[model samples]
Target: MAVKIKLMRLGKIREPFYRIVVADARTRRNGKAIETIGKYNPMQEPSLVEVDSERAQYWLGVGAQPTEPVQRLLELTGDWQRFKGLPAPEDALKQAEPKPDKKALFEAALAAASSEPVVEATTPKKKGGKKADKAEKSDKAEKPEAAEKAEGGEA
Candidate 1:
């Protein structure tokens, strides 16, 4: 059987992840593999590609032909260059920055909302303003006296 180095599909639909494998060339794309050597995740911020250099070199030495995409991945990890006795490739990808946690973000917003000072509501002054207010206050103050006088006189 002709040995081949290739990628096997994994992960959820529309979100593909792959495993580098050594298998028979005649096997289906995702069929059984003789050995798994690495992983690839293209969905991440800085697409992730990983491979075992020693195993990859061994496979290459033993006449395992890598598929085109797998060759590119091996190149990204510098395994392909190393296998060919070439110098290390320059940085092809940057590391992704760590993202803040959702819970931490929510807590920060809650703390900000609570730290702000509370505002009290006040009634707006009417058209008559001070005169209307004074009249209303005087009316309130006289009602009890007027009711008391009426009650006393009736008794």
Candidate 2:
């Protein structure tokens, strides 16, 4: 069975307490959990999030996926980072700050476009539509005069 690390609801109506657990993906929201790894209490001021980093990292490393809100909780504990082996938050900020030059980006895009063969559009254009209509009317007017002359000559 596909496994997911998600929440199990435990508290009374409108007063919610969640157990962050590793459970089968097919199970109901508060069903039998394979293992409880953490707890989340949003009712408290500043919120309370307690997660076992080692257990969380282990479950994530072994392919147990966390649900959206659970993923955010794992991020709070840095369990997600530890599982992925990313350098700590401070180092990540330093690496992320340097923006690429716009000129370099534009030149790279231009080079790629130049490498590809250009394609001409094959759809017919409507630029000459009015002129074509006028030409058709002129041709029809000339045809009737030519037909009259031919009939007069036959008479």
Candidate 3:
């Protein structure tokens, strides 16, 4: 039978926590798991993640596949690197404590959302003009060129 290393969602809506578990692939997400491997609380600042390294490694070695998010959590906790025959828990702990680049991530998301090209204001450029003048210039510029052409034809 196929086994999975995945997260089981818990806690209230908007405030989510999870259990890292080893379970049969057919089991429902929050159903009975074969083993509880750890806990994850994304609600907390810095987000708490605790895992049983030995059990996690054992499960992986025996062919349990982790879901994408679970795999990321494992990487953050250094479980995958350790399981892949790297350093021990102490070294992993040392490496795991680095601060996440939240500001850089936020800026990257903002940049992605604003990726479309933006047009410059078509209004006459104002030099040392008050807000009201700027508004008037914008209103004047917004008049369609077709309106100007019609006015000229009437003349």
Candidate 4:
């Protein structure tokens, strides 16, 4: 029987979490599994991946083929690298603790948004020679004269 390492879907609609498991290749997705080895939570910032390294390596050694997403998760959790006899990644898993407080981050973002005036970005005008400059000057000259006439009419 061909064994496959794959993700078993869980969680509510529109919010997905997954369990990494080893099962018969012909088994339906989200079906019964031989063993659950880990979990993946993509809803978290940067995503959360946890795996049982020993179990993962043992299954890989015994010829369980990993599905693409499972393989990617293993790569992330450093299990895939260890399975391939590679060195542990430097500071990757270690640095995974919440780097900053989430509430503080949210408040700072909100404050920044509220404190600033929204300005639309204008595309730069293409540079042309004298004709362009003359046209620009004519436009500039028209605006203030129009403003002056309005002011005079008000007076």
Q: Give lDDT: candidate 2, residue 65.
A: 87
Query: Each candidate's TM vs. the true structure?
Result: 0.64, 0.56, 0.55, 0.59
Tens digit per residue, CA lDDT, model 2, 1-155: 78999999888899899999999999999899999998988776557788887888888888998999998777777777777887545422112245789999999999999999998789866768889999999999999999999999999
| Best-fitting candidate, scored by TM-score | 1
Choose 2 or 4, whichever is better by TM-score: 4
Q: What is candidate 3's local distance difference test score?
A: 0.86
Candidate with more favorable, higher lDDT: 2 or 4: 4
Give the alpha carbon lDDT tens digit for every residue of 1-155 in model 3. 99999999999979999999999999999989999999999877668889998899899999999999998888878888777876644433332466769999999989987996887898977666587888988888878776889999999
Question: For model 4, how does the per-residue alpha-carbon lDDT over 91-134 read when each residue is reduced to its tens digit?
Answer: 47433564788899999999999999997669776688899999
Writing each residue's lDDT as its tens digit, candidate 1 over 38-146 gives 9899998788888888999999999999999999988888888888889988977567888899999999999998999886658764569888899999999999999
Q: Please give the ranking of all candidate structures by TM-score, highest first, separated by commas.
A: 1, 4, 2, 3
Candidate 4: the clashing residue pairs are none
Pairs that collide, model 1: none
TM-score of 4: 0.59
Q: How close is candidate 1 to the true structure, as a TM-score?
A: 0.64
RMSD of each: 7.4, 15.2, 15.7, 12.9
Q: Rank the candidates by lDDT, best first.
A: 1, 4, 3, 2
Cα lDDT listed for each candidate:
0.92, 0.85, 0.86, 0.90
